[model samples]
Target: MNIINRAASILLLLVFFLAFFQNSVHGRPLLLSMSRPKPDDAALFARWLVSQSSWGVLNTIASDMGGAPFGNVVSFSDGLPDKGHGIPYFYLTTLDPTARNALKDQRSSFTISEYAIGTCGKKDPENPSCAKITLVGKLKVVTEDPKETTFAQTALFTKHPEMEGWPKSHDFQIYKLEIEEIFMINWFGGPKPLTVDQYLQAKMDSHTVIA
Candidate 1:
């Protein structure tokens, strides 16, 4: 019995470690071995964080809940793999409170952490060096412009293939955050003072492996 128990314990530990490292190894599409940017490159770091991550907590003002802030786990994409454009695009439906809330009030914010991308190994999510970003902006639907809608659809579908098969009756539409302010923490001191223009303008190095 003691031998069996020890073997079981060892198996569990092996599974845990594999699960932890697998994200870095296979979670991303093309980025199999991309190293994170230095803490000082605020814009590149922020863009990298957004591009590498596939989902995040999107916060909106819930009108039905007495104007309270509500955060929902949502899937989003900036672009395909290493081609991210820095603006997060989402596929949402009114059946969900998040889309309903956005329709009533466009004010919103989206937050993503480096921990999700698997680079912040062994560090608590809240640890100062773990790196996190919150994009403050107005969430708006993108059906008005045919060009933008096409881009959104391609970007979202490429990253999240399952979305293509999502129930159409739910009326999922493309929505994007028009980032106005950027707040990021990659190192210790405090939130990195990043501007929307800076973030959008920041260019990823061709050599940088991001996917």
Candidate 2:
């Protein structure tokens, strides 16, 4: 190869290594924020975590398990990536205990972790700095409004392409968390004091850039 082409090839390889170091100590996003919000900015931090996560543990008031807070890992979405509305939506069915429990009692909460996105550095998953949130509210099935179903289907299929091909026999239905409270810890001290109003209304227009 010519000397100029050889020089360009080396430069590209160096650039690639730098990018690997920068993104994963590290993280990447598309309907996601590039960085964590200041811990004190409770509202922003809560919103950032929720918008970036595609799934979390959903808790419900169990009936068969004797009313315990039964937690189940499930997939979810708030909106389309960074364009979220700060409300989490889900795809579930009666085949799962979570959905069945929700029908008997709507009281529920959903929890997500920043560590799942690889932005927690080397921190342990349970470490406070890794960032975790529990959104408390009601989990209800969507019995009406076809439009909401359409929006949810698009959101789910986009993030989890595999769901599109899942067996039709499973009969998955749409569900949502009507958030009434918020609990989050992105750093030290303790869970930041944030309320549902502050969380849902926090502006994210500045963080709307997508991949």
Candidate 3:
């Protein structure tokens, strides 16, 4: 009987470990430990994609490039793992063209692809089923208020630890996308018409289950 009990205990431990491994991706815990939200729920789905992503393409008008649109790959975070504000924050230096462009013209947009989160399975990134979002609005530096700047820096540094060690001479500052419009495509239909308010107000409750 003792032998049988010992075997059962070992089996239980194995099961628990398996469950933990399944919930984690790349050996890191997922934000909120939740799966992809249903595509029908545009607001929640958009928020989930933003929260899970660590990087995206930030677009700005390039005056030096003849007033053309320029896109740069950048790292960003919405907030800490559990508390996502759905507002993308970035750390940039004026030495980089992205920051310089933003200063010249605040008109900008940030795009995130669900493929980066690794939930799309074998689907191509451009596939309709694979979700993507573009936040269209102004990209402004967050420096006027000390409190807001501190909060933005914290939100950025927590997700991107390497930022803390960047050279100070580069003068890296905080910038955020003030989302005026949200365009998301997660399914066969056209892009979902999600307003900035709807995207910002979406809640990630217990019912927002994984795919």
lDDT of 1 by residue, 1-211 (tens): 9999999999999999886776446555443344577889888888888887889999999988999999999999998776788999999999999999999999999999887777788999999999999999999999788988888899999889999999989999999999999989989999988888888888876436634
Cand. 3 TM to true fold = 0.84
Model 1 clash pairs? Answer: none
Order of candidates by lDDT, top first? 1, 3, 2
TM-score of 1: 0.85
Task: Please list the residue runs of candidate 2 whose C-alpha ends up more than 4 Å from where it truly belongs after superposition.
Answer: 1-4, 14-33, 208-211
Q: Give the C-alpha miss distance for residue 197 in model 2, angstroms.
A: 1.1
Local distance difference test values of all predictions, in order? 0.88, 0.83, 0.87
Candidate 3, residue 17: Cα displacement in angstroms equals 11
Single out the weakest 10-residue window by summed lDDT for candidate 1: 26-35
Ranking by TM-score: 2, 1, 3
- Candidate 3 lDDT, 1-211, residue by residue in tens: 9999999999999999888886674754454456777899899889889988888999999999999999999999888764678999999999999999999899999999888777889999999999999999999988788977877788888988889999999998899999898889999979998999989889866444554
Per-candidate RMSD, Å? 6.0, 3.2, 3.4
